[model samples]
Target chain A: AQSVTQLDSQVPVFEEAPVELRCNYSSSVSVYLFWYVQYPNQGLQLLLKYLSGSTLVESINGFEAEFNKSQTSFHLRKPSVHISDTAEYFCAVSATTSGTYKYIFGTGTRLKVLA
Target chain B: SAVISQKPSRDICQRGTSLTIQCQVDSQVTMMFWYRQQPGQSLTLIATANQGSEATYESGFVIDKFPISRPNLTFSTLTVSNMSPEDSSIYLCSVEDLGRANYGYTFGSGTRLTVV
Candidate 1:
């Protein structure tokens, strides 16, 4: 079984400021990590994912996350954020096994970017 | 990523009523899933819809309460039976993206259900 924990429920940041959302997970086996963004009235979009190889992954939107095996964490960060970046971000994990792909999502973090 | 078309973006139903949400993928997908997002909670897997076979449900969910149907590789539906206030939540359907290296999942826009 796998579970994800998002440390913060809401984050307030000024435009062009930095932000980080913490996420930790517990799984007995190797798992794939993903960050998804959900804008207002829109569906979830894949920000970036860490499956194998590099411990660091980045999204096109100036966001990046590190897969820390020792810390059991995958925290999303952005050096500067835009007002349009205001949205809910989710951290998810699923077993690396081929057949089963049921994802366990963390409680979402609502990022409120202010002007 | 596979594009999904989900019907009934939102609805308000009376207690004891049922709602059937549909999910249609643009291309063939091997795996389809049903998920629920309760208010202020994370997304939880409800079941895995297997084409031409019975769906596999998670621990707390049941086939009776959440009947799933996958008649083909590109389509699936989930019915929330005998709904109640507690059942009010955002229901989303996802399909596995086989083209991706990680086989990431693509989600629908979701159907927001409100039980009165």
Candidate 2:
């Protein structure tokens, strides 16, 4: 089984400021990490994922996350934020070789971008 | 990624009644999953709907409470039974899109159920 933990419940930042959303996971085996964003009254959208190859992964929307194996962390970061980035972010984890597609999500961290 | 659609985007139902949510995928997928999101909470997997077999439910969820049917690769349905105020939440269906090298998952818009 895999579990994810997002340390911050809420993170507020000014527009154009850099920000980071912390996420950690516990798993006995190899795992796949993902970051999803949910806007108001909308379903989740995949921000990015870290499967293999590089420890760092990036999304087209200028968001990036680094998968740290030793620390069991996959923290999401952005150099600059926009008002549109104000949304709830969730961190998810899944076993890499379980043959099952079940994902364990964290409680979530609400990002508030101030203008 | 596959384009997915869910029916009845939002609904209000009486307690003890049941609602069936439909999910359709534009492309064929081998696996479909049902998830529930409580108010101001993260998603919880209810069951995995596989074609030609019984759905595998996660812990704390039962087949009777949340019955799932996957008759084919591109279509599935999830019925919430014996609803209560606590059962009011958003139900979403997701499918694994293997076309991407990372094998990411795509989710439907989600059906919001409000039981009164």
Candidate 3:
């Protein structure tokens, strides 16, 4: 079984400031890590993911996350956030089970970027 | 990545009623996932539907309460039976992006059900 934990329920930051949303997971086997963003009234969009090889993965929108196997963590980071970056971020871990993959998601963190 | 179109974007249903949500994928998929997100919470996997097989449900969910159907490779449906206030939540459908290296999942916009 796999589980994901997001410690911060809400985070507030001013525009152009850096931000990080923490995500930790526990799994018995190798798993794939992903970060998803859900904007207001919109569907979830994939931010970035770490499958293998590279420890760090980046999204086109300037968001990045590093897969730290030692720490069992995949934290999302952005150098500068914009007001439009306000959204709910989720961390998920997918592991193969019964020849199929199952995903476990974190509780989610709400990012609020203020100008 | 496969694109999903989920129907019944939102609805207000009375207790004891049932609502069925649909998902249509742009491409063929071997598996489709259904999830629930309560108010201010993260997503919880409800079940995994596969074509020509019985849907596999999670620990806390049951087939009777949330019946699932997968008639083909590109479509599936989830029905929330015996609705109550506790069942009020956003229901979403998802599919894995086999074409991408990350193997990330694509999600539907979700159906927001408000039980009254």
Candidate 4:
């Protein structure tokens, strides 16, 4: 069984300020990590993912996350955020060895970018 | 990634009634799943919509409450039976896109159901 933990339930940052949403997972086998963003009244959009390459992965929208195996963490970070960046972010983990192909998601972190 | 079109973007139904949500994928997908997102909560997998077979449900979910039908590889429907205020939430359809290196999942716009 796998579980994800997101300590921060909500995070507020001023426009152009930096932000980090932490995510940790517990799984016996190797796993893939993903970050998803959901705006108000919309479906979730993929932010970035870590499959098997370099520990660090980035999304086109200037957000990046590094997979730290030792710490079992995949924290999302943005050097600068905009008002448009206000959304709920979710962390998900999928066991690589599980053929079932199911994802276990974190509680989610609400990012509120203020002006 | 496959694109999903979900019907009945939103609805307000009476308690004890039922609501059937539909999802149609643009391309053939090997795996399609249904998820429920409660207010201010993360997504929870309700079941795996399997083609040509019974859907596999997750723990705490039952086929009676959430009847799923996947007639083909590109279409599926999930019906919420005997709905109540607790059933008021966002229902989303998802498909696994193996073509991507990261194996990311594509999600539907979600059907917002409000039980009154």
Best by DockQ: 4
The DockQ scores of all candidates, in the order shown, are: 0.80, 0.84, 0.92, 0.94
Assess the local accuracy of residue A104 in candidate 1 as a C-alpha lDDT between 0 and 100: 86
Provide chain B TM-scores across all predictions: 0.96, 0.97, 0.97, 0.97
Q: Summarize candidate 1's per-residue lDDT along A7-38 as a digit string, tens digits.
A: 89999999999999999999989989999999
Query: What's the distance in Å from true for residue B33, model 2?
Result: 0.2
lDDT of 4 by residue, B87-114 (tens): 9999999998887664799999999999
| Model 4 CAPRI quality | high
Candidate 2 local lDDT, A19-104, one digit each (tens): 99999999988888899999988888899998889999999999999999999999999999999999999999977544655588
Candidate 1 ranges beyond 4 A from true positions:
A96-99
lDDT, residue A71, candidate 1: 95
Candidate scoring better on lDDT of 1 and 4:
4
What lDDT tens digits, residue by residue, belong to model 4 across residues A1-115? 8999999999999999999999999999889899999999999988999999799999999999999999999999999999999999999998855466659899999999999
RMSD of 2: 1.2
Q: Which residue pairs overlap in candidate 3's backbone?
A: none
True lDDT of residue B2, candidate 1: 80
